[model samples]
Target: MIVMSVVGVTALAVGGGALLMTDNNASAAKETPAQQAAARAGMTVKCPDVATSLSNVPQQARPAVNNELAKMDSQVADAYQRLAEPGAKADQESVRTRVLDPLTSERRQTLDRIATEIEKVQPRPSGLDSLAACTVKQDQAAAADAQAAAPNTPAAGNTAPAAGAQGTGGQGTGAQGTGGQQQSGPQRADFVDIRKVKPNVKNPRVQGKGSKGTFSSRCGRNENKHFNSDNVIVAPGVSNGAHHMHDYVGNKKTDAFASNQVLESAGTTCTNGDRSTHYWPVLRLQDGTKEFDAGAPGGGTEGNVGRILRPTSVQLSFKGNPVSKVVEMPKFLRIITGDAKAFTNGTANANASWSCTGFENRQLKDKYPLCPKGSNVVRTFKFQSCWDGKNIDSANHRTHVAFARADGSCQQGFKAIPQLVQRITYKLAPGARNFAVDSFPEQLHKPVTDHGDFINVMSQKLMKQAVSCINSGRKCG
Candidate 1:
C-alpha cells in the first residue's frame, strides 16, 4: 500500500467486508475452499466509537466523560477475549448468548452514566444509547487471506499487491509465525517486498509564503527503556488504557496519571531541553523470548508477546508549513496521528507509513514491508499541522488539529503550526520477517493499526525558537 504524507490528498481506499454467506443450496455449491475457510474463522466484536460523536463536551464534564470512554474500550477488550476463548465460537446462538449480550448490557450502562455526567454540567447528549449495542464480524485477518488466495484479486485489507507476487526483495512468508507463539496475526498476506512498491509519496506544494525551515529534536532511541501501556492524553488517570505497550521518548515523566503540572516540572530525554512527550507502539520480534511485561495485562495477557526490539534510530523533526508562516504550538497541545484500531475501525484515519531505510520513497500503509538483506524496517508518522487556534484539544482528540490541504494551506479559522514528523528505524536480522508491533488483541498486530502520540510541553523559549527557525527558512536543532 502506498502511503502519502498526511498533508497530501489521497483517495480513500476501503477494504474488507462483513462475513460472506450463501443464502441457498445453489450458492453453497459454488462456494470456494477459501470462502469456506473464511466462514470458519473466529469472529470479532465491532462497536460504535462513542468518542467520535462527542463534539461539545463541557470542561467540567470532560474527566467523567473520558473515564467512561476508557471504560467502553475495556469493555470491548474484555468481550474480545471472551470471543477468542475455546468453545466461544461453537455456534452463533452461543456466541450471542455468552459474549455479545453481556457486552451490550455493560456498554449500555456505561453509556448511561456518561450521559448523566454530561447532563449535570450541560444539556445531555442524545443518541448515545444507540451506540450501546455491539455486533460480531468475521476476523479481518482470515478475510484478507481468503481474498489474497482468490485468482486476480487483491487482499481485502490494505493496498498491498496480491500475495506471492514476484520481485518483492525478501521471502514472501511472514516473520510472526516463528517460535510457535499464539499470536493472532501478522499473517503472510500482511507483508510485501519493498522493491515491488511504486514511489507514491508526495509533499504538499510550497507556496510563496510557505515557511521553509526545519527544527529537529535530538532525542535518543529510548535508551532509558521508558515503556508503558498508559495514554495520558486520551485516558488520563486510567491505567492500562492503551492495552498495548508503548515505547516512549522525550518527557521522562509520562503515564496515564501524569498531569500537566507534573509534565511541566518533569525532566526530558531530548538533548534540546524540550520536555514534550512522544510515544508509539513498541515493535517486537516473535522469537519467543519473554520480556518483563510477559504475562502482564498489557503484554502477554493482552496478546502482545515476544522480545521488544529497540529502534536503531529515532528522528523527531518539526518542519514548516507549505503555504504560510508557522505559529508556535501551544503548550500541552496533544495530537494522535494514526488510528490504533484501524484493523476494525477501517482505514479512513489510518496514517501508518512503513518502508525500508534505502527504499524510503516507497511507503506502505496496510502491509509491513519486507526489507532485503542489510535494510532496516522504518515507521514514519507525519502529524497534522493545522491547529484550531483556541483549544489545545477536542472531545475526540482530533478535531482540535487538522491536516493541511494538498496545497499546504490551513482551512479558514485554523492556524498553520509546525508539523511534527517522527521516523524510527529498526535493524532486523537479514531476511528476518517475524516482527510485529504491539496492539490491541483484536487488532491482530496489523501494520495499519500502528500509531503515534505527541504532547507539546516545550518551554516557551524553545517554542518561539522553533517558530523563528521555521519562518526564517533555517535548519535549527
Candidate 2:
C-alpha cells in the first residue's frame, strides 16, 4: 500500500513538470518567423560562474544536458541549411525562433559557463586544429547572431548606386545606374563636307553681248536633240499648246540693275534651249610678285583689272554635250578698282557697280546672241580681285605669293596657293606704301605711269633683293 502511494505521487509530479514545459514553449511556437528571429537575436547568453554551480550538479544531469546540446546542434545545422537555400529565409527564421530562442536565454548561458569551466580544467591543446575549429565556430555564431538581430534591415536603403553598377543594367544595381549614361553622337550633316566652286573673272568665253544668230554648227545639238549638258540653255517658249513652259527670267529682260555675275534671262524652264554659257573662278597668289605656275594654283578668287573685266572661257553645250569655248568679258562683268587710300588702310571693298548689258543707258538686248531654233540661253559671271603691278599703284599692288584655278582651266598656267580663302584679309603684308617717281627709269609700262612710278622702283628693288638672296643661298627663291 505504501509503494502504490509513492507511485501516485511521482506520477502527479511528472504531469505537473510536463505541463509547465508545455506552457513555456506555447508562446515561442505562436510567434511569427520574423518575430522569433528578432527575439533570438536580442536574447543574451549571460556567461555566469558555471564552474561553481557545476560542482553541485548531479551526475544524472549530464545526460539531460548532452541531449539538449545534441538537439541544439541538429537544429542549428538545419537552420543554417534553410537559410542558405534559395527562397527559404522566412522558414529558416521561424525554425531559429522555435529552437534557438529558448536556449539562448537559459540553456545557452549555462552551456557557455560549462565550457569555460572545462577549458579552465584543461590546458590548451598542443595541436592548433582545435583552436582553428573554435575560431570558425565563433565567426559563424557571430554572423548568425547578426542576421537574426536585423533580419529585415535593408543593406543600402539610402545610399546611391555603387561604383561598379555603371555598365550592368538591372541585376547589379550599381552597374545598371552606370549603363544609363547619355552619349553624344555626331550629326549627319556634320559628316558631309561640301566645297563650292568659286567663280572666275579672268576668262573671256562667258562675257560679251548676245547676238541674233541662227544655229550654224551641230557642235551643241545631237541627232535626238536634247539639252543634256551643264550649260544654261534659253530659247522662246515652244508653241506646244498643251505645255505652257514659263520662261525662266519671266518678263525680266537683261537690265543694268541685275547682278553682273549672271545674266537675268527668262526664269522658266525653256523647252527649245538656246543660249548657254559655263564659267569657273580664277585664283591669285597672296604676294604681288609671284608668277603664274600651273603646277600649283591659289585657293580663292582670281581676276584682272585692265580695260574690262571679262570671262576668259565658257563650258559649251551642243545638243546636250558640253563644248569648251572662249569668250571676251561681257559689258556686264566689269571690275571697279578700289581707291588707293582703302588699299593702304586695309579697308573693306568699295560698293562697286556692274551692268549685265553695259551701263544703265546702252542696253545690249538687241546684240544678245540668239539661241538655236528650238533652244534658249542662260548667263552667269564671277567677281574677282587682282593685284598685278602693271596698272595698279605699287602701294595697291599686293605680292602674288600663290595662284589657283577654279574651273581647273588655269591650273596649267598658275601655281597653287597654300592658304584658304577666309584667311586672305588677315595675311596681307602691312606697309605697302608707294615710292617716289624719281626712283624709276623712263619707258616703263604706260599703265604703271598712269598709277605712278611707285610700283616700278619697288619691283626692281625686290627683284634685285631676290637675285642677291639666290646668289648667297642655294635654296633661295
Q: Who wins the lDDT comparison?
A: 1
Tell me, by TM-score, which candidate is best.
1
Q: Candidate 2 — worst ten consecutive residues by lDDT sum?
A: 435-444
Tell me the tens digit of each residue's lDDT in model 1 across 1-477: 111122211111111332233223344334454343333333466676677667678888889989999999999888877765532222445556877689989988998998899889877766666766676555545545534444433233322111121112222212122232235556666888999999998987778999999999998999999999999988999999999999999999999999999999999999989999999999998776778888787788777878999999999999998889999999999999999888767788899899998999999999998899989999999999999999999888898999999889989999999999999999987656678899887677789999999999999999999999999999999
Return the number of clashes found in candidate 2. 84
Model 2: per-residue Cα lDDT over 196-232, one tens digit each: 2122234223212211111111111111222110111
Q: What are the lDDT figures for the candidates, one per model?
A: 0.76, 0.20
Model 2 stretches with alpha carbons more than 4 Å out: 1-56, 90-477
Clashing pairs in 1: 175-433, 175-434, 176-434
TM-score of 1: 0.86
TM-score of 2: 0.13
Per-model TM-score, in order, reads 0.86, 0.13
- Candidate 1, lDDT over the whole model: 0.76
